[model samples]
Target: MIPVVPLDRSREAALRALVDGKAKPLGALGRIEDLAVRLALISGREDPSFDKALLLVFAGDHGLNQAGVSAYPSAVTTAMVATLLAGRASANAFARVVGAEVRVVDAGVAADLAPHPALVDAKVRRGTRNAASQPALTPDEVQSALARGAAVARRAVEAEGFDILAVGEMGIGNSASAALILHRLAPAPLADCIGLGAGHDAEGLARKHAVLAQAAARSDASDPPGVLAEFGGLEIIAMAGAILGAAAARTPVLVDGFIASTAALAAIRLEPAAADYCIFAHRSAEKGHALVLEAAGAEPLVDLSMRLGEGTGALLALPMVRAAAALLSEVASLDDVLAGRL
Candidate 1:
């Protein structure tokens, strides 16, 4: 079990006082104040620093694509991974604007990826088995993926000195996998969890719905690990592991939309304390995202109609996180302002 320590709330009152003491009226900063408090609480510091942020985008293929769940082919997953590595994808552009570094993890991409410094080759296998036909991952593969994900996050903090972590994913037909995981674990109905992942048409959506129904029927597992192993894409499970790992290290993780939120749900379900360290980035245009966010009890920072995953939402939200930290560290207290101690 990952030893995810519960966030300490002992500093709440003091943190609130600090925020209220800022050279502004009470609640003037709005949700930023809440965000600052959360950052402080996560770091256990009155002046938390989010100067260095890392976005880990775990990429993989899903065997369930064979079942016609996605509008795109499995090959798109590889092409997207290449695009990300070439610094040409939407995620890379957003990351450049946000000043957060992006690293792609080969959790289980179907094709062999040439080594890139920014790519962490943690492939457990060449993708997972089709959940509609069999369990997506074996118990052992699940554990390994979880471990590698945790290690990646831990190293980011302990070795690379990043102050914050975020997670995204790339996998074709993985939305079907995420929906299945969310349906079983969120205990939401299967219908509620299904969405127009990667822009499915009416017929495509119907096919995805039917395929997910078949996968859901094949597994009755309600527990976190069991549910993940049964329906998770390898990248999805690795993203959960990254969440757990970040929480274990006591670093806040900015969770990206629908797919990443599903991973966060699995992580929190596996280790309840992990929820405290997650910052749900944004709601997406994806239909099922709202339900997943609701199930996770998360109020995201923005809703830009964004559904282009690969950490784009989280990267866009990074400035707000940086601003929150600045409010705590740079803003002066009202008392000092009044005393002309600026």
Candidate 2:
């Protein structure tokens, strides 16, 4: 088990110096400045470099399909997973632009996918049990999903030599699951955080809310693990574990949209120290996403009304993070340029 560490004063000092550098005014870069500083502190490097980027896309299926919450069928998860492996998905295009490596993990798709070179094949189950009717996953399944996610992160940090981890998910009706998780974890109402996932109509939205409310009633928010086991999707559970594992390994994490943000919240709930290593990539347009970000105390870097959950937003924010790091490491201090004390 990797040991998770708290942010120390040394790391904090490094961030302050980097942010207070000469070329740019203090806090001028806004959240991007804070993001680079946080990344530097987490990696324990004054001149932090993000040359290697690892994106782990967790694919799963939700049992809530029976509730008519999603316009697409559960099989879409498997199809999209395959698409991702083929490097044809939108995430692929974005990742290609950033020169990042993408890996798809079948956390628990409903379909049976044969062995593929591009897919990790870490399926935990066929699909989660319908949360509207019963618990989403058994305790064993939840544990397995988390273990797989942690192992993925460990591999990226240790074996693959990646410095940063970005999380993404592909699961039908996952937006409903994310909203439910956020509602349970936060002291907020379901209506506040729920959104029109995948462009659902009024009837679909109502059904989604009803199913989520039922699941929430059966959940125990005081017990986060139990809540996750009962109502969280396989992708969400895996993401939570990945976040925790990355923090334990001192790898900076760029948290994506709504689903990813909810997963980060779950991980932080399990271990508060995990938040120290995370950078909120963007403010998702999903109704509940902003509330989740607020609950996490995270100010995201971008807010372009993005509803995509495939780490696309995080990929967009990467250049800003790199620029901040470069400024801290390469830009000369004002005193050095002026050749005198200010």
- Give the candidate number with the greatest TM-score: 1
lDDT to native, each model: 0.91, 0.83
Model 2, range 1-342, lDDT digits (tens) per residue?
Answer: 235788875668657775687567777767666666776777677788988998889888999887887988887887888788899999999999987889888888888888877678778888888988798888888888888888889888999899888889899889988888888786478889789887888888888888778877776655777778778699999988899889888888889999999999988887888888888889988888888988898888879889988889888888887887886778777667678643
By summed lDDT, the worst window of 10 consecutive residues in model 1 runs over 287-296
* Model 2 CA lDDT for position 313: 88
**Local error of candidate 1 at residue 277 (angstroms):** 0.5
lDDT of 1 by residue, 244-270 (tens): 999999999999999999999999889
- For model 1, name the residue pairs that clash: none
Could you tell me which 10 consecutive residues in candidate 2 have the lowest summed lDDT? 1-10
Best candidate, lDDT: 1
